[model samples]
Target: MPEPITQTEYWNGDVGARWAAMQAELDQVFAPLTAALLDGAGLRPGERVLDIGCGCGETALLAAARTGPGGTVTAVDVSRPMLERARARPAGGSPIAWIEADAQTHPFAPEHDVALSRFGVMFFEESRTAFANVRRALRPGGRLVVLCWRALAENAWVHVPRDAVLTVLPEPAPSPPGGPGPFRFADGEALVDLLGQAGFTGAAVAPIDHPVAIGADAEAAARFAATVGPIAGLLREIEDPALRERALAAMRQAMPAERPVRLGAACWLATAVHPG
Candidate 1:
């Protein structure tokens, strides 16, 4: 496995476990983005699909449904714990093959007609190499449709909570500008450049802005902010109980009064074709 050790350790450990536990909540919150990605995939009744970074398998299951019984979907991710959760879900007649492997170097069969991901392609240690590998997994003229964050500044769901936490604790050192993280592909041109370098042709990146559900209520949203995603990771680093509680309170205070608080988020819906 040539994956970055830090990412592997983080996802396969407590973070992954936490995500698995909160899979339902996470899925519901990000349902719109998932829908958008699937909508753009243009899946047919019998087209083979490859789902990268399949998390808890929501996207894979949905893709399977579109592919119908005659088609197949191969869903891959690095987190075994997540894969366990995915496997535990009812299949609902979707033919999905869940594999716990790093997509960057995994020996995928070269048969898929489409490759799809939702916020999954950003974490590759080497974007070009990983995408090249993805391209190789597809038959000629296969399509790639992915959804990735546009920019941290444009995503209130992410930056707002982290900012709240930072009021109580020092901001952690930033990762490399285009490093392996959620915001790695935030720049649309950079993403297009990466795909082009990876042997993909006619790469197009478009903005997909939507309102994402945070929680059923403000309180629940606050709790989610403190217990999941990047803010949660930051909270773990704060050893002082008093400080952590203060940070949590700050985040909680920032949530809106609306039920299922809808926050604006921006992502790039990138599309490309594998050249013949």
Candidate 2:
């Protein structure tokens, strides 16, 4: 993975706190989608599941309920501030074990039955290596499932705001034609291929057009974006003061009054069985 440009600032600074709070808001916007991201996890009554980059613990908490009393769920993330919110969450079931480690290189046990990531695998500088680490963390018969964006054009939530932010900032690191944006795993085929290279088979991707319900006002939404999510930081690079204001202003106006705006976001709901 590309070395984090600002590891310390990104991980433990105000940006982190802003993001945690921002995620809290955005997750609420994505609550419904969260349920579907976990649609087929098959979190049986007594099985274990690992939620990688388990943002805000939404899916992790859901998996915990599925596991019931005999089962366990371990949720891991790279951010302490984010995990703090997860850890401090009111008791829903068994307290989820929260681990603060890079999902790419954490020393993970290989006994878990399933490994899952929801909109969390895209930040890696090196996708192959990250998945390789995740593969090593799973048992021989385990499965890996992930949900990522489809393409930039498919979703206004991403591209629209991205267009707004980038206009305000300096050009970012070059991204792929259709991907490597914040939502790198947008291509299901690409994910399947990568998983195969990482030594897993039966990788499959399913499309999910989740209508996101954003905040009631544009300013609220922009605050959420500029502070916590990826767009704001990207916009910070814009040296042209007028362009920056216009871009951010555009994002605010982009907010939809109707909840669940039918913005197309491809959720590559993929699962690959570990080769025994």
Candidate 3:
């Protein structure tokens, strides 16, 4: 069998392309969560910021606006497609450097006032080492703020459709323990402990729950769920077109009747301080 694909390869492949194409829609769906993360970050004008896993540059652009023209933003991601999409967008705030590099090992200048991620951070192959690298990039007492999914069960926007699809396909094998995946840090205590291990201080996590519209209708919602997020990952492995269609149908049938199907999203707003 071929060697397993690395996270860099995974994101740079078709997954990245899909995300690049759906950037606007994904941003709209997660707008509330983005707001919560930015508010929690408390970015100030002229504060240099490091945006980790800055896919399509939504958080980075918004952060730039908050920090204004005097500030600078280093937005890093492994996916070239997403970075290209981000670079193509209209930017009106601080200067942003959209670098197609892995944040886990990037040699970021040690001058940022804050490090931020929106649904990033969780994909690190070495979670502790990655955060430690981020910590090293921050100045004394610099803050790290991120939004990560809380748990599969807690996130109805994912699990509801996931369960629906699973009815048609077998459950995929569980990810390796403490492995890199969306819900890797679902346990708040475990996440805080990892931050402490990475030499961060005063680590804290708070739940930020909100209703996110997945699509305009059941069909749209089904397509949205099957085209992106965790469910998309699951469907990507299936080679049989007929079976895949069945799974999509299940997802459509599972959606609520609301004109714009909305589902609850649960996430943790984790924050930490870098020791000088």
Candidate 4:
């Protein structure tokens, strides 16, 4: 089957390239959330783990460490560019298998003891089907842990830059409520219900708050804001180069002068179990 059209284009094109180039910086920005996700997974030695949306393999490497030499990690993602970067990194003796495939339709063995993701599970066009497939990949009673953004309003790192960009370009229409996107699963009750429908039991979603460091200073942060993620996506739509620079300048003005520009962000640390 073919990949999801929208994501296949975005991730394989500019978005994927930008992420690959900024992998280290992005990883550092989200490091605390990664640590929380790994801690919540409670992985033990000798367990088989599946890391969905494993960009650049950071979480997969961490999982491999927690699972020890006897365990294994299969890291899957849809972007070839991201997977290329992931494969380029040294494994440091950790057992990991990197696969480029969409989690929604990929053929997965029902052999994994745990499945986890960090800010990676949200982009599914059909989340219910995607999560059901994830459940199918796990052994009986295997666990699922995912971290997802809470809401656009709750994530200053995103909304602030996004707003600044809008000052110079047309604002894109908002995604439908509960639709596929970063904040699609923001509501805890909605997520729990969706997981229940996808054959997961004991579903729970917990709120996690953290201050994310976007860059070392306002200028750096503004540059990153204009060149990455949602803000960048918006900027890309503008045909005028001057307008794009205007957006960048607006972002710079909006950002604080303090070093290591930090923004308050919130996400849901969700977990569920496959029934035996």
TM-score of 2: 0.84
| Candidate 1 lDDT tens digits, 197-224 | 9999999998999988887876677788
Candidate 1 versus truth, CA RMSD in Å, comes to: 2.3
Cα deviation of 268, candidate 1, in Å: 0.6
lDDT tens per residue, model 3, 231-251? 898998999999999999999
Residue lDDT tens for model 4, 144-257: 999999988999998988888778777788767655677787788999999999999999999999998998988898878777766776777778888777888899888876
Q: Write the per-residue lDDT of candidate 2 for residues 141-171, one digit (tens) a residue.
A: 8888877777667776666677766654555
Q: TM-scores for all candidates?
A: 0.96, 0.84, 0.98, 0.95
| Sequence-dependent TM-score of model 1 | 0.96
Weakest ten-residue segment in model 4 by summed lDDT: 2-11
CA shift at 257, candidate 1, in angstroms?
2.1
Question: Which scores higher on TM-score, 2 or 4?
Answer: 4
Specify the highest-TM-score model's number. Answer: 3
Ranking by lDDT: 3, 1, 4, 2
Q: Tell me the whole-model lDDT of each prediction, alpha carbons only.
A: 0.88, 0.72, 0.94, 0.88
